[model samples]
Target chain A: MTVKAGLKNMVLKGVNLSIGYKLHGGKVLHLQKELNMELRAGELVCLVGPNGSGKSTLIRTLAGLQKPLSGSVILDGYDISAMKVPEKSQLLGIILTERNTVDNITVFEIVSMGRYNYTNWLGTIREQDRKKISKAIYLVGLHGFENRFFGSLSDGEKQRTFIAKTLASEASILLLDEPIAQLDIPNRVEIMTFLKKLTHISDYSVLVSTHELDIALKIADKIWLIIPGDKMLIGTPDEVIKSGYLDELFGNELISFK
Target chain B: MSKKYHTTLISLLIVAVICLFFLDIILGSVTIPMRHIINILFSRTDNKGWEYIIMQLRLPRALVALFAGAGLSVAGLMMQTLFRNPLAGPYVLGISSGAGLGVAIYTMLSGIIGTGAGFIISKLNYLGQVTSAIFGAVVILIIVISIVPKVKDSVSLLIVGIMFGSLATAVISVLQFFSTPQLVQKFALWTMGSLGDVNWDQHMILSIIVITGFAVAIFLIKPMNALLLGESNAVTTGIEIKKTRYLIIISSSLIAGGLTAFTGPVAFIGIAIPHIVRMLFNSSNHKITIPMSAICGAALLLICDIISQVPGRSIVLPINVLTALFGAPVVIWIIIGKKNLRTSF
Candidate 1:
């Protein structure tokens, strides 16, 4: 059982994956199939797609929140589907698109929730857990805002709080679904840049689905362009632009990337 | 909002609860002096009349107010959290309506079923009603529990609960239409809700159930806190969603069902007290809210009971009437005055 790890330090790998929903009468609605995706440690990847192109479905499938229609998701060396929830949680974290603003909960409390699996049955925050929670709040640039009510914070601050919660988990792989969807231009740019900085400084593998193609192209280490017909074009931003599929998907006349 | 402020507020609530507890016992149809009531409670009073008034009449009634208030409020908090709906209460899941239906069947159908059953039921009386109410509540709760696995989300389950409630109400309505006026009045009086009907034996059972419910709520604080982060986020935090949901549902049902069995589906307190406590503490931390809700709920119900007795007046209003009259305005006032009221859901 002495299998050597890969040279590139792949943190998350989706092997021959099929992503979709199981509808009424056990009818399988396949969105995409046989998609082999790789997210390496310290890499920032952006999954760009048209409105109905299954970006969220892919992220959910890879995160193991939803079962894959077929194939497997491997985390580090173990099979994701086979791993228990708490064990899988220690390795992966996700920030969903829903802005679930809990009323009356403070930023500190929300971030402390990331330590749920690590805490005792009573969810007591030990000194070490407290330090990690504080560090996470600081890392997300929300130091003084810790005691502020989550509902009172701005949308940007709220998103940062959620990110802080995810960061507190110390998961190596982070998946975000439309993290900056509702933000204004400035806040959007700030969140994207903050995520970019996170990937560079830490051994975290980040995958975010976004409609902000320009920012994604500018900062992403790799661009995964999903188009119609359940197909994905995976490569560096330069390779994606040079391939001319980006222009074709946007239709050369309406909106060209290059 | 500060820890110190919360401490001060909690202390204030405890003092209010104690004072109200005494006030509730002191201000019934026959107002008794504090000293006399104390002497009676401690068994040192020679005034048999005051002693009887305090011990037999007002004492059990006041205790009912306290236990029902606290238990129902905690149950309401759980339902609100589980459903993420501001209007959700202990009755939202149709547990109360099911209890009502159970009562409706017992009170109205017994005579029609024949004199043998009616004789037994008449002899059983209060015990029969409590048994029937519990049976009804447990039945609806079991049905709701069975549907939990089938539903995809909490919202769907909330709808299912509402549907079951409506179904129970419809059945009760048909029974009412066909029954005699006196029997219908008996059922109607039960619907008006009461804190005075529970005897000492029932009080012992209610106390045990409410105390156990509080203990279970304490154990659920962590998982409930995790749930404050929406369902998906909660799952990411390694919370067992199905297990947590089951614990919350069963515990809330036990408290709400037990209280309804004794108190005839006491209204408003269950749904309103949680909101008031949340608004007062300005914290959604279950650690703080659960205990605070208990105290505030107990205080509110005692106040309601005092008002219902009308001090020197012999006429007593229904408990539900006073609760809705007072509970509605207070919740409205808090929501209106406090613009920064956070949505605890």
Candidate 2:
């Protein structure tokens, strides 16, 4: 559990990781293998490859939602693979593809829940929590719509609600799986642009699993080009983009932004 | 104030509740006058028998209807929103069946165990029934929690809950098969679901529990709203979804389990009223929805209670039968409406 020297920069660590899950037929198939990756601070990292390349599995494993077959996901040098539920929540903020519906609640109150860790066991909101919610709304560019109904929101607006909620968590690091999966084209552009802004100014690292390679290329600070045949090529976006890794990785299956 | 709009609706519901209360007091198997009941309340001299009949029989029955309505309605609202499935309610989770199974056990065992001819004539027997119902509800809740770590979809989990419900019902039917004819009559009567069995003391206890259940549900609005999106989404917002889920199931059980214990399993309001509230309020805020559901539930149940009493001459119908009459169609509408709208929950 001790923090190592080079590991100080690591927000998340997956050492010798094997990520996969049981299918509907109840068979465990390996999506990837023996991978040790360090996700650093304040970097927007994208995972891109062909269909069913285990992009989501990797995010789920690192987010502590699933158990890895081999190796460990060490968050902030702490072995989070076996951490308690509440303890795990404090270190990570996650946005998955799941859609939510609790009827008749405002976007503000929903986003404010990101402060659950900051509140007491009784779970009442504090003034500081209010401040965080306002900040998150601002970050998501949802300033005037605080009182809007979540059920009434457009898909883009709802996505922003979830993002504001994630922001309210005060998490130093985020793991997003297909953040734009439910968004329209324009909203997709806005969320990615905002995510890019988050990396530079928010001092928070984000690891996103996405099929939108073109969007990721335009925004990501770094790219973790997951080509699925060998070691993951990790470097600056310019380096990864210029190397034609995205084209070779997709192999003309129509997943690339180009 | 939008707060004022909520308050206005509550006051309107209370007014409806009061009208229903006095209406129940006046119109009964023997029709009494509004003037006479008022005189009886302040009659100075102890009109003990008449007062006892009015206070004991009529008032408690009506209040029981009110609280029972609130409890089931709130639990349904919580469950429906949490699961994001329109069909999800306390009944879907097997909580109602769990409570019914408890009643079935007591009703059947008291026969084989043959405690007495008038076993239910005593208050202790009622207490036993309540405790057993709570025990059954707790057992189902535990099973629900164990499955939480396994399943991801709220709708699929609801399906699991309903499957457990069917299992509980199947077991109860077997108990009904073995129990004596009279005991079976008692069990069947419980299933018909009336508010009449609540005497003064039982009425107070049920009221306290229902009110407390509501308080706890409103208290968890932050996490409950967080929970709407999904478990992990809630957690990412610092909501411990596991604990929040536990809180919701337990609190929902406390309400649904308690009402089912005393009043039998009343249907419809739990399933229908939250939707009505959501529709009327036009917002997705629990701050509004919680209170809105409470009022909408109370008013709706008051109307149902009045309708149940409408046989008029002497006999009264069971409230549950009347509720199911209204409830089933609303559910059908929601199902059909869901078909048309491409939306979540």
Candidate 3:
């Protein structure tokens, strides 16, 4: 056999992927490129780095929101571009930074959006659809908010409501871009920990981008330190814990973890 | 209590309506009391013109206020929910302008339809006007659909709708420039908007159109709620967002289109009444919003129509002028409300 670092369920490959766009650097306009990335399922991979490190641009390419500058994104030995939107939606559940609200919409109604792939064009919810909605709401711990007006909820509650919406998506691979950016401190911890447990206990896997280095080291099964002064590396939180990654990440002079 | 609550609202509105309708008829430019007005409506009156004034003129005008207000406002409530924008109204879709152009085109051709007579309307030509209004509204609706983006965020879509309204206005103005004096006068009069023009037959047509259109709109309650959460979110939640948006625009346009086609461009109900319903119900749920706007819109229009008349003179204000009097203030009020202001997204 061979040595493989990630958990058993996930094995994804990126073949010579080069991604970037033109950015103006005063006198000159140039392109930024990250040549490669390989992700495995069952690992909490954190894409941590500095502001202009192309972390978001990299994530955007992986999520199929943008076309790659060059190279291929292959998932489970299948070309990503060939897959249908519905099929892609089923495989990857994404939590973007955008929040959704409706006047008379309940938490359950919003979460039920995850089941659209199963519903017909006529727009009616079936029995299994209801079950999925309930499961999603329960997963996000928003049980009683089923009938609340969407606009009345607080910001933190709104974020959790979106997570509940994501849960109903029934995806095996989760991609989150700063999911806790809109949350309170307690909610941030609660949501992050809950997501971590879900990835560890279930067959699902998550790739998240965040600035919370302390929390990332504490829970992540594997850390992806997008080093400032070097190439990207994948290892455990302990291995990358004392590296200069955090110091360069925040541009702090002392380089101490609070 | 919920049953009693709606009943109480219905009862109160009905009572207010009786007072408003009587005041609109008997108190206009004359001090006829309750008994004389009853005599004018039913009994053989000594006056030659009394029956004509009460039967043909006053009664039709009152019905106009009742239907025009409720029809446009109910349409507005549905649109605001459908598009998730408080500013969406019949005017936004260019329905009024489109239908007006259609009627003007019909009026120019009214002579050919055998109804073109000076101050003496023939039934055949009048029917042509009705047909033209519906056709115009439908055609403009199709054009607007082509230009509108089916994106999730309806906030920017509102701007697109406003742009469409301006475009339609420009086209109609060009149409007006080429028309004869008589036809131009007719179009101008129609645009000023009046509840004083339609007869009993026209009223029946508008009633049927509004009732059917609103019925279709009511069926869309669940889907509209789903859409407000976001299109992708709505789609995954078992709603076909594009199909739903199409259904809603068609129904709302039909109702508002039918009304404005027959009655010119009655304004206030389409823009202001939905916000009023939101404030009163303290909820934006369509179940409450739809029916509440129906009742409240009718009442508000009846009041505005009553106010349009001089309390004791022959002076009559155009319905459009009166709606603008109230609608403009509401536009400013909406701009000042912080809840509305917070939406930059």
Candidate 4:
């Protein structure tokens, strides 16, 4: 793992980033601040935190979907704020928590949206685009479900479809917001395992915010653990576990980690 | 829907539209013969009276019906897609109500200013009404659109829209109360929504606005498709949500406002035609639905216009009455019959 870390190149870096929302009257509701972090190539990093621990804010800030209250995020050595949406999308993909309620859209069409930046003004899918879409659907194990309505899918299938959509972009980095929050145990395990394999197969960096710490610990190369009102704890899963911060933050009299 | 099947369906719709167009022209008060109508359109006809009736009145009215139908339907589709609310339509959004209010205010102004200014106002009638209606629709749309981001959900936005419509109606009532009886009757007639009221000059303006609106909607095909996944997801896919929203609002207002200006708040067609197209096409891809909705809408309106004329009789019913009679039931059918709506919406 140390040797693998040595070979991995840094894909995303946050320098002195502050994550929060600004309320009215020029007041800033700070969540976390001055935290520097790095996501390396071919690494699946899990961001585990309690509810309202600013995990989503961090993910959104990192994805460039929301602005950082202070400091900056660098993607492939370029400032993310300076890049156009298309240019940023080419390098970074985001899977939001919002359920796609569009009932008439097919799985194929939903997956095809991943190629938005690559498609023409008419969004006409060429030969290359078709191959990418098919490959993405196949990657999610939804090969024959292309023409099926997205709303007809099981929760696991739907989440996999979203993952497929993110993959179809050919983005070097992915930021998923609570991807498996609504899934069953099997689905969660399946998604985490797939994400782990994906990082191993390709030099794609994944930063997924999830509450499923056990699955994340089993699959993630690095853990970004937010302990609330304190600096985030980042290290290998074993290292984080050994630090005793996990027990101090999450353990209780009735429920404690072994 | 497969590509081949879609092509077949589209061709059938085009044929239906053509048949309806001719039928609309032929079945007016006099019931002009189909061959004579065809010859009147393509070549000279010997009968001056028939030629004048077909050319001057029926032809223009049919043309108005065609454009108005297409415009209103496409506008409704845009609203439904943009808000992601199946119930959303131009009328529901208070766009037409705004137009009605504008015309009411104009009539009130004419009444207050008396006969000295009445002649000038009447002279400026269609142009004045069109400008005011467009202005009013745009204002209401802007208000509704600006509130979109602030609202928590589409249900709230829809409620806000309905409230705005009610507000406009209330204001129009006040104007009607103050206006002269003659002006009130004129505005009332306008409210019933007649396609035959528009002259060639007014039709030319309506056609220009509606076509421009359609052109804009076509340009929005890609962004709209991206938006089907909802705005946040659409943004991740590199769609500029603000710009797309503005374009959609502009295009919809142009079409809805222009149609209302000419036809006086023709209802049902705007809201119903999109669902019909969606059901017929079995797909929500904007490319297929947009053009298909336009064609289907045109055909529906022409049929409505024919029915409104009350064929073989001198009396003509209001266009709004027929559209509501047809459109409401179709919408109900879509809701109840297609249980897939829960999935699609």
Query: Stretches of candidate 3 above 4 Å error?
Result: A1-94, A100-154, A167-175, A183-186, A200-207, A222-258, B1-66, B82-84, B103-135, B149-157, B171-185, B199-212, B230-238, B307-316, B329-345
**Per lDDT, what order, best first?**
1, 4, 2, 3
Query: Per-residue lDDT for A42-69 in model 4, tens only?
Result: 8899999878989999999998988999
Docking quality (DockQ) for each candidate: 0.63, 0.41, 0.20, 0.73
State the fnat of model 3: 0.28
True A-B contacts kept by model 1: 0.67
Could you give the DockQ of candidate 3? 0.20
On a 0 to 100 scale, what is the lDDT of residue A241 in model 1?
94
Between candidates 3 and 4, which one is better according to DockQ?
4
Q: Model 1 — TM-score against the truth? A: 0.95
Q: By descending DockQ, how would the candidates be arranged?
A: 4, 1, 2, 3
Candidate 3 residue lDDT tens string, A107-224: 6667766775776543467998899888878877878888775677877778778777767777767778877767778877887888887766665678888877778888888777
Query: What is the model-wide C-alpha lDDT for candidate 1?
Result: 0.87
Name the docking class for model 3: incorrect
lDDT per residue for candidate 2 within B1-345, as digits (tens), equals 276786676677768767776676677676665666888766633667767767778778778877877778889988976776666676778887888888889878877756665554454666777777777877887888788778766567788888989999999989878778889897888888887887778777787778788888987877766666566566656566666676777788788887888888888889888877766555545666777777777777777877777734667898888899988887677667654222333
Q: Clashing residue pairs in candidate 3, if any?
A: A10-A41, A112-B237, A113-B236, A113-B237, A116-B236
Ordered list by TM-score, greatest first: 1, 4, 2, 3
Report the CAPRI category for model 2.
acceptable
Q: Can you give the TM-score per candidate against the true fold?
A: 0.95, 0.84, 0.70, 0.94
The number of the candidate with the highest DockQ is: 4
User: How many clashes show up per model?
Assistant: 0, 8, 5, 2
